[model samples]
Target: MRKDSEHPFRQFENDPGRHALVELFVREHCGKIKDLLRDCVPLAKGSFGNILGIRGKAATALGLALKEYPRKYESVIAPFAEQQRLSVNIPSAPRIWGSDQADGKDYVIMDEIPGVNLWALPQLQELPRAARLRIFLDALGIVDQYRKAGKRHNDITPSNLGVDATGDMRSFDPDFMSDLHQSDTDRFENKSVGSPAYMAPEAVINLPAGRGPHSDSFSMGATLIAAITGEILPKLLGENGVNDYFFYMLNTEKMQREIDVMLHEIIKDPVLLKVLLRLLHTDPAQRTVEPELRSELESGAADHRTMRYILDDYSPAYRTAVQQWEERMGMAGEQEGFMRTWLRRTAISCEKLIEFFKGLRNV
Candidate 1:
């Protein structure tokens, strides 16, 4: 833990120990996101960057937020990453161990996902189908499961979805990302945790209200479409245009049809197509189905572990963050969509899972 990796601001200069603590603070409740990469992937010790901001204050804020929103956000992702767990074949996160630490601080030891960006893809046409399928299934299962559960990933793009030399595709950007509930006018690290181009219109235009599950659907849609066509998604968009010209590139009759029709046909599976369509709906309210398609996508591949919130107990921190959020830039309750309901439900389920594991007697 070098001090350079925190923000570059001078405020953190005096407390490398605190910065380490802040990172560890987030890491503790987050489990070993770092270890996940170390155990499953490869990495080089990259050069470090400068520290920034007040490490102590940031650590305090994280603690407060965790205490506040623990129940709402715990089950959804690892502390440092956005992730979940479902059936084994579905390829979700793994179940955590040694929870109920009284101190309730789990550290994320893993860094971002391990693999090259799909955007920087290498030749893989000759790769074995089994290898590719592993990546594809893992990503698809999680995407489908969470969407159906009413959660939306703000960023789903080729860059976020990693592909190794084997041509496997897994979402690196997910697991341990931001929580929807804690989002407000407050000041925390502002990452679009979701992707930019892959995000649905609702996700992009969010301000009066936040985006929902469909936003993730759109990202998946774009990613999947790119997978089929083998074209860069960003290349299709124009700087001056608002319309999603990317759909037209599908080169199908459905692409020329209405927006709804276009959405339905983007993928061959009728069940998944419908879920995707609902996720892409402009009106979040009209799109409230738990998007099974995306979840199916993510879970179909790998079963990841849930080590972050469960052992760390950071939900209360999230809840407390609401008070810290900036006054409604008028973003609250501005738009009620099916996604909102789904998100709430998803958060609740995550909480339940944590409680379930927590309630279990010690070994």
Candidate 2:
């Protein structure tokens, strides 16, 4: 029986760009979606794709399509609920992977995330680079889990990041629908990986391992610099933006862009530079280790202290960001009854956090 659309998925059509993706979603999957998807409200679609609200396993179809790892993708997302471990200021539902419904065609299911777009960070020119970098760093943890399990993120950029009112960072737009194939099944990246604006220098060359962790790291660095500075490096670095990889690396003009001036600083910072540098390296073998990447970031913690005056400064965002990092890394303690029945669950972690820091003032 077609149950009343009481579940959250019904509300998904209101999501931006998702409506369009649904119309095209027909051919991608092997079979048809049983969910009676109503008309979806359209929003501005991203450069490559659209978004949609789906119930059951169909909700995750777009995501699972991006990479061929149906089973491992399930394996990677399974731990998120336990892994995110947010006490407050969290999203209502656990986005952690579990099957709600898969069309034999899709293979895995994902929960629908509600609330606002959570994409306001891009507009704030005064936001701290470190704070945004913090979000990207946590994102890396998720990416790391997938790679170890043999998965890849087809999209990585500021627009893909979701930040709540309480400043929680979550990943969305798992809709890499173009990568899924009818017969293929397993981890593969025949399609271009992630976005171009923040793509690694190697990405222009279409290297498989080109952007890996380092590529992600470099893009994160670029995102941070752009967020704080309102500047963007030439996506290709130089001629490499068009063709020829080795020559692009050796080109001096590529390194001298207005964006590169500050980018070079991050690329040079003792603690921060190595993270971005490894991501920018021409060879995949010279990747920056993830754990060590964050540590190097801490090595430059004082860099944020200078920017404490701005509304977007790291003063408060830094604290929340660190807790988020701890949550992603599983360093934070588990709560007694913290089942993510509500999005506020994430916020609860943040609230408890505020109290803890507030209490520290008296002590």
Candidate 3:
């Protein structure tokens, strides 16, 4: 566990002046916040600022994302205020109390949310498989509501997901959130704005492809796999050198059988297994829970396993990318057959994945 003294926001440590600023802000915003300055706890540190938890009058904890940037308070605080204006179905998410700027810094007070981050849990693997499955579903439901409201949660990872005291899932941190209801005129600049470990294949190559709810599905899918298998998806994929093509191939019946064999050692239900496999579809359009996929899920065909993945049905972009890759491989062995080339590529991906996962584990 990280100690409070080791917290990155050292500027606030033993600083009576900063504490006074917090006190002044709370005194002014007493109608919205109900915490004494003495109860504040530095919960986390992010790219922009420190997340402080306040023990308020209510049963639940109140949080504050206090801006610690050198400047640009408007840029840091505006979006969080705008995001708080919107709400999702989840009881503990983006339920922001209010925002205020004082002492040349901005702060957005929100629900501290009970329980620890999913990754920080000491015994995530000890939890029942049913519990793990429910966590992903609940998280997806939250994502669905956000999408319905035309907002996109660009980041979905274990660290970002929180399991409350009652074991209910919660989604927080609207750091890179974008308004889907808005025009795409400014989409180009938001190319890569999420955690790479849970990012979709399209997201890794191009940000625009993953700038929607389907991208969230891809990330959630990876998170679900990790939850059940006691393995981080990126670490697993990196260890195996698995790429987008490998995930795409998992759509095939033969590949499904291979996956089944691999997962036999890890307990999983057939339907849930199919759901996890579907989430990793290389194409963002197919991976996203569109009307058809939603209908399939609603109709209880999640475990049907009849979805055929023919090479001809492959997305043109995916096919072109793979073709270009194969062409590059052809340079190394001009006479290699298609099957041989695929096999070699698969071997290389596995080698790289293993190496990468090993490095991550060490870290």
Which candidate gets the maximum lDDT versus the true structure?
Answer: 3
Every candidate's lDDT: 0.37, 0.39, 0.49
Worst 10 residues of 3 by lDDT: 303-312
Tell me which of candidates 1 and 2 scores higher on lDDT.
Answer: 2
Candidate 3 C-alpha lDDT tens digits along 1-363:
111112111222123433333333444465443233345556666446777655433211112333233245343222755666663343436455456555555566654443456565433345544444455456667678667767766677776776543334667676666676432225435443456567666554442344544777877777766765667664554334546544544345544454445544453565455566667665666665445544434454211011111111222332332243224333222432433433343322444445545655797
Structural similarity to truth (TM-score) of each candidate: 0.39, 0.46, 0.57
What lDDT, from 0 to 1, does candidate 1 have? 0.37
- Model 3 segments more than 4 A misplaced: 1-27, 30-39, 55-78, 88-92, 102-104, 122-125, 181-191, 207-210, 239-267, 288-363
RMSD of each: 18.7, 14.9, 22.7
lDDT tens digits by residue: candidate 2, 93-165? 2232322234322222233332233244443334455654554455455445435433334455656655432
| Candidate 2 lDDT score at position 28 | 39
Per-residue lDDT of 163 in model 2: 48
- Model 2 residue runs over 4 Å out of place are 1-36, 39-49, 53-109, 114-119, 122-125, 128-133, 174-194, 204-214, 235-262, 265-274, 289-293, 296-363
**Superior candidate under lDDT, 1 versus 3:** 3
lDDT of predicted model 3 = 0.49
CA lDDT of 162 in candidate 3?
A: 63
Model 1 per-residue lDDT tens digits across residues 1-363: 111122111122223332333333443444433322222312222111111111132222222111111233344333432232321122232211122211233322222222244444432222233333344454555576655544444556665565321123344434433444434122123333334455555544553344554455556656754554465344433222334543342332343235465444444555445544554455545444454554554444232122111111223332222222211112223223322332333212444444444544442
Quickly count the clashes in candidate 1: 94
What TM-score would you give candidate 1 relative to the actual structure?
Answer: 0.39
